[model samples]
Target: MLETLGRSLDSAIRKIRRLPQIDKDAINALIQDLQRALLSSDVKVELVFKMTENIKKEAMNTTLQKAKRKDFIIKLVHDELIKTLGGKKAPIRIKPGKKNIILLVGIQGSGKTTTIGKLSQFYKSKGYKVAAVTTDTYRPGAYEQLVQLTKQIGVKCYGNPKEKNAIKIGVQETKKAMNDGNELIIVDTAGRHKEEKELMKEMAVLEQKLKPNEVCLVIDGSIGQQAYNQAEVFAKTTSLGSIIVTKLDGTAKGGGALSACVAANIGIRFIGIGEKIDEFEEFEPTTFIGTILGIPDLEGLVQRVQEAEVMPDPETVKRMMRGKFTLEDLYQQLKSIKKVGKFKQILAMMGGGNIPDALKDDAEKNIEKWRVVLDSMTAEEKESPNLIKKSRKRRIAIGSGTDYAVINKMLDQFRQMKKMMKRFTQMRQKGKGGMPGMPGMGKGAEQFMKKMSKDFKF
Candidate 1:
């Protein structure tokens, strides 16, 4: 989601690596590039300046004994950015008392209601007796939208359209939920524009009556720098504990929301990537930084992927690394990868760029087609792709409900990968000589790959 910013930062870091040393001048230049990148993304000028200052100071003062200069500089920048966003993660306060109320506030089209539903699902998944209540007496469809969403999530929702008293509805709903054995009451209020004073007053009254444990402001990542202005206005009316940035799945300027949190002095609690109930992710600083830096934090991604399937055998990975990767092994790898969501995200986590715009749709179709083709192949065929001739291809196409063209494409891709692996194996056997166009391919690359190969044999 922060693709632009990520790329810009990566480029800046690459330039830093060319410098002779991490001196004051080099650090200042790096900070200047970062400032330009943040400003180009429409971040607040003051915030950008402050961030650059922090990065420059940290990079100059931090002690680096054994690490590479570039690595130290990148870590400095990452740490400073985290500090600007919020030094320590702030979690939503859930009291031990009877009913812990959480009130959500935001402008229209800010995803306030949907965030409430997502939060309710998040709590419900955590084994909390959670219920949602709509006190949005102003908007016509507000109550219905929340009601339908809560029902879809199988959570209780309290709303009365005829009642104009939002405070009374919030109080009654909280009381009823407490008596009904609900420990958490999430109040979804009507969306009000930042300029609406009357609506703000009403929201304040509801907050006063409910005495919510947490007041979260939902923001749209696509709003860019405007997210900060919205948070400022909302924070003035009520104490906002955290922010929930939604609509991160598309081409939204998500970095702006990160900047907004810094400006508003609020911690981000959750990030909504899609409309699905499971799309909400708790804010994690290190993993987020790792992703933005184009470093595959395989440990983090593997945990999420593991939730969908049993862990792949370490022996299987070792076999593949040893150049014995077969179609059977490929099938198992695909099954593990598919659990982590889309192909694009998986590739990005592997330090690859986004799928080419023209190939994005085709890539998804190819994945679906490949799954069916693999399912149709026999055990012997899967163990050895070379055994698949034209007749086998035809059989697989007919069995999988796909065309011969799809089968041919899958075989072509597999052959290309096989050729690359064969070349790698040959190079590894050729005494540690550096191969042409091979990254880290000298003795260092070979040693690293060999170590990884051995380590994967769990």
Candidate 2:
């Protein structure tokens, strides 16, 4: 999502690797490059300067006795940048109370209504009884938009277009939601310019009336520094507890939202990565820094993999490790992987690099092909792929509506992966094994197998 800035930062960090030392001159050059990149990405000038200055000071003062200069510089930059982007993580406060209220505020065209819908959907998925309340009496379509969105999300919405009193409407909706057993009520206010004192005052009244747990300022990422200014004005007028940057998909200049967080002295709790309700992501500084630096954080990926449910038992894992992995295990793995989301997203979450362009383009098609091939297999053949005779393979291929070559390719890939796992198990047994680029003893595979055994049943 931060692909542009990520590429720029990755390139800048790579330059450090070629430097002889982290002297002042080298550090200054790197800082200059970073400043230029941030400025170009629409980050506020003052924020960029502060960030670069911190980076420069840290890089120049870092000792290289225990670590490489490049590694130190990268770590320093990552930490400082995260600090500048609001060091502490912030989460929405949904305490055990009568009704937790989150009031969303933003200028017109900032996607406030859409964000409310998305938030409702997000909370609904988490098993919260959420309802959307629109107090936007200014715009004609505002109430309609919110109503349609809440209905689409299958959540209750409270609004009355004819009600001219925004504060009264909000109070009534809050009471109704509470009486209806709604745990969370997201109030969508009319979008107004931060400069509009009257509208800002109205927002304050609504806040006082609703006593919202969170007053989230929704800023448009594409507006860049302008959005920061808007956030600043809003913060000056209201208690802006959290920030939510929207329209982050594609080539949006989102860095300004980070700058806004610094300017407004608020942490970003959620970011809109796409139009879909499920596209919001909670901000994690380390992961965000890793993603921006284009260094896939294998640790994060390993955690996600650990969260996934793989089939079979300790005996099965041991058998697979011993080169006896069957199609049954492969089928189970496929089902688990499918639960994790799209292949590309799964890879990204695992700190895997960008899929090759050709592979990326064909990933969905490949997945479909695999699903078809798996579906066509007989129960006996799937349990023991080696039992599939050539004639059975032809019949299965015909049944799946895919060519025999595609079937053969799937089998070949499965065999290759199984062989590699077998070799890894042997290496572990001989005290000479580990996954390539994996840290420590090649024990992660064994640990992963053991963990899977506990979590999954055959």
lDDT of 2 at 335: 43
Q: Rate the local accuracy (lDDT) of all candidates.
A: 0.72, 0.73
- lDDT for each residue of candidate 2 in 1-458, tens digit (9 for 90 to 100): 86688788888887876776667777888898898788877888888888888888766765332225566677667777777677655567796546899999988878888899889988888888999899988887888888888888799999888888888899997789889999999999988644588789988888888889989988878887776678778888789888888887754477776666666677887788888778887777777777887667635544444333222345655566566776656545444454443333323322333333543333334667877888888777776777777998889888999988778866765675466556556655665535564334344455544444444432
Candidate 1 residues 269-370, lDDT tens each? 888888877788887866776677665653544353333224335575456447787765544444444454333332232223343444444344577778
* Candidate 1 local Cα displacement, residue 352, angstroms: 40
Q: lDDT of candidate 2?
A: 0.73
Query: lDDT of model 1 at residue 210?
Result: 88
Question: In order, how many clashes per candidate?
Answer: 0, 2
TM-score, prediction 2: 0.61
lDDT of 2 at 57: 77
Off by over 4 Å in 2: 18-28, 65-67, 193-195, 250-252, 298-458
Error of 2 at 373 (Å): 70
